[model samples]
Target: MSETILPELPQELWRAGKLELAHGVQQFLQVMRVASAGLGQYLAEIESRGVKDLYGYGTTISWFADIAGLSMGEARPYVNRAIDLNPTRALDGTEIPPFAPATGAAAAEGAIGAERIKQILEILRQIPAEVSVEDREHAEAKLAGLARDAGPRQVSDLGEQVLGWLDPDGKEPKDPEPAQPRRELTLQRRKDGYWNLKGLLDDEAGARTAAALEAYAKPRPVDEFGQADLRTKAERQGDAWVDLVDLAIACPDQPGTNGYRTLVHVTIGLEELKTGLGTACLDFVGTMTAREARLAACDCLMLPVVLNAAGEPLDVGRLRRFVTPGQRRALNIRDRGCTFPGCHRRPKNCHAHHIHHWADGGPTDLRNLTLLCSFHHRLIHHGDWQVRMAADGLPEFIPPQYLDPLQRTRRNTLI
Candidate 1:
C-alpha cells in the first residue's frame, strides 16, 4: 500500500500548458469518452428494471449520484441512458431490444432513457434514414403516448408513416438550411415589459455555439421517480440536469470552466429602473455547466450588446471595466452563469451582461449589469429572441417565429 506518483517531468513547460499535462488530459478524455458510452449502455439496463436492486432505488437520486461522483441531476441521465440504450425487452417482447445498428438512436435516446429510446426507435424505423433529428424527435414525442397501449395496428400505422417519410417524393432532401447564422444579439424591451432578442451566426459557428450552450442546459438526474407514485417531476428533472452537467464538464469536449454555484445573477427591471419597463435574469434549463461558472464569470454570463427600436444594433453593456474583483465576488452570489431565457450556463461560461452598458451610458450598479453565458449573450446579441426586466426586475425570453409561430414572450424568475 504505497502512494503512487508520476515521475517528475522537465520544468519550463510551454506557456499554454505542460506537454505532460496535455498528454494526461488527452488520456483522461479518452477514458471519459469510453466511460460515457458504457454508461449510456448501463442506463439502458436500469430504465427497464427499476433501480430497486440498486442501493438508491425507491429513494432520492442523490444516493445514485454519490456513486457517480456527480450531482443528483447529472446522475439521472446515466440511469436514463441505461434505460434508453436497450429497453428491458425488444419489440418482440422477448430479449430486450437494441437500436438498429449504426442509426445513432442509442446515443440520443439513451440520454433520455429506455422509454424515450422505444419512442425514438419506433419513430426512426418508421421515418426514412434521411429525416432530421428535430423532426424525428418531434415525431417520437407525439407517438410516445401510445407506448402503454401499442399494438399491431399502431405498429403498422407507424411503419406506413415511416415509409412516407422515407420517400417524400418531389420534396427536396429534408435538409433545412441551418438556423440563421448569428452575428450579434441585440435585445430591446418595451415599456410593457416584453423584450426582443435578435442576432446572427453562420452554420458551423451557430451550431458549435448552440452545442456549447446546450452542453450545460441538459436536464439533471432526477428522472427515476415519476408521477405514478414517484418523486415529483421537478426533483427528477433537476437531478437529470445536475448529472448531465457533471458528465459534460468531465468530458473532453466541454469548455472546462468551474464555480457554477457561486456566480450571482441580477435581474434588472427596465420598468423600475427605466421608464415603466421590467428586467429579468437568464434562464437555466435543459443544459447547464458548473465549470463555466468558475473560471471566467465575467465572460461567461453577461451579454455586452443591445438593440434599439427599428431593429437597430447597439453595444450598450460591457463587462470589461464594470466587473471589479470585489464586484465579481458579489456577482458570483448574484448570477450563477449566463442569464438567458431557458439557458443554464455557469458564470465561467457566461459574460457579465449589462442592462445598460457604461459605454452606452449605462450605470455600473447591479441595476443594469447581469449575467449571460456566451451563447445566450450572443442570442441576446443576435438571435430572434428577446430579454428584458420584469416588474420584479428579472430576465425574460421570447422565441423567434420559427421556434414558435405564436411568437410569445416569456420570463423566468430564476437566473
Candidate 2:
C-alpha cells in the first residue's frame, strides 16, 4: 500500500462547527481501530513463530509490553485478541480458521473498537463448551453484528439473554468437590497494634453472616439536629460485626465464656477510669484509650480491673457500676428501646446506658440510666450525641450542633 499522508491542520481547526468537530473525532477513532487490528495481526504472527525464540521474551504479551510501552495488563488482551482473530497454520501445514471471523473482519475494517471486540469475545466464550461448533459460530456472528450498532454495555446485556435462549434451564453439570471447603480467614496484628482481618466464607456461612449483619446494619436515623447516618456501608458493617460479637458474648448459654458473659478483660488505672483520659492495657495484649475503656466498662461488657499508678491492683469498692436487674427492668419499661431519636430497636436489643457514666461517680438509678442499643451505646460514649433524663423522668437525646443548629432535645417516638 502507498504511504498514507495527512496535511497539517489550519489554525482555524479549533473554530470548526460542532458537527464538523464531532465528525473529525469519530474519524480519528475509526483510524485507531484499524491500527489496533493491524497491530493484532502482527502480534499473532509473532506468536505463531514462537515468542521466546523470536524475541527473547517469555511471552508475546511481554514483548509487546516492552516494545509498545504498554503495561502487561494492557498488553495481555491485545495478545489474546490477536490469537482469537488471526488464522494460523497447524503443524501438519493445514490452515486453521480464526475463532471469531466476523469480529475479525469488522475490526480490520475499523467498524468496531477494542472494547466492542472484547465484549463480543466474552459473549462467544460463554457459549456452552458442549455446543456444536456451528452454534458457537452463530453466536459469535450474532454478537459481532450487534456490536456494529450497540455499545459494549448493550452488547453485554444481550449476551445474558442469549444464554437463557441457548440453555433454558441455565443449569450446568456440577464439577467434583475439591479436597476442602473453600472457606478461609486470616487475622494478623499490625506493627501499630491494630489487627487486620481478611476472610472468605462459604455460601451458607456468607448468607447467614450477611443476614445477621443487615439486621443490625440499617442506616442511622436523622437526629433532631438534622444529622443523618454519615457512615459508609463498610463502617456500618464494621460496627455491625462489633454488635454481633457483643450479642454472642451476651448469650447466657454461650459455652466458652466460663459463666462470664463478657469476652475481654480491660485493666485501667483508677485515675484513667475516672478521668476518661490516658491509656489502659487490654487483656495484656494491647492498649486502648481510657475513653474506650470507659465505654467497655459501661454495661460491664469487658471485665475491668482497676489499678493504681504503681501498677498494683486497687479495690474499686462495691461494683455498683452495673445497673441492678430491677433498675434495668424499670429503664426498659421507661425508655422502651434505644432512646435515640428515630431508633427502632426493641427493649431486648438495648443496653441500659448510664446517662452520666458510672465511672464518673454517677449512680446507677432509674433516673441516671437510659436504654440504648449496642450501636447507640458506643455513639453516646465515642460520638457527639448527648443524653439526659427529662423533667418528666423520661430519657431524651440532644444532637450535636452540627446535626442540629439549634441542638434541640429530641425523643425517640418509635416506642
Over 1-415, each residue of candidate 2 has an lDDT whose tens digit, in order, gives 1122232344798788898778777777777788888888888878887788887999999999999899999889999999999886666767778889999989987889988888788777777778888777787788888888888788888888877777667655576754455789999988799889899988888999899999888887775446688889999988888777766765657787632335567878899888889998888899999988887766764666789889888753334476655776687777788888888888767777888888887887888888888878888998998998889999888887877799888888888
Would you list the C-alpha lDDT of every candidate in the order shown?
Answer: 0.49, 0.80
- Per residue, candidate 1 scores C-alpha lDDT tens digits across 1-415 of 1122334444655644666788766555445444555566555555445566665467335556876689878777556444444446543556655443322242332222234344546555546667776676655544444433465467457645755765567345466775544577687865554555576877787787566555644543331112132535545444444445544543335453343222234333323223313333334211113222222333333442334454343444544333554555566576666565445556554456656544346665565667665445655654666666666655556677876788676743445
lDDT of 2 at 16: 85
What C-alpha lDDT does candidate 2 achieve relative to the native structure?
0.80
Cα-based TM-score, every candidate: 0.25, 0.75
Worst 10 residues of 2 by lDDT: 1-10
Angstrom error at residue 153, model 2: 6.1
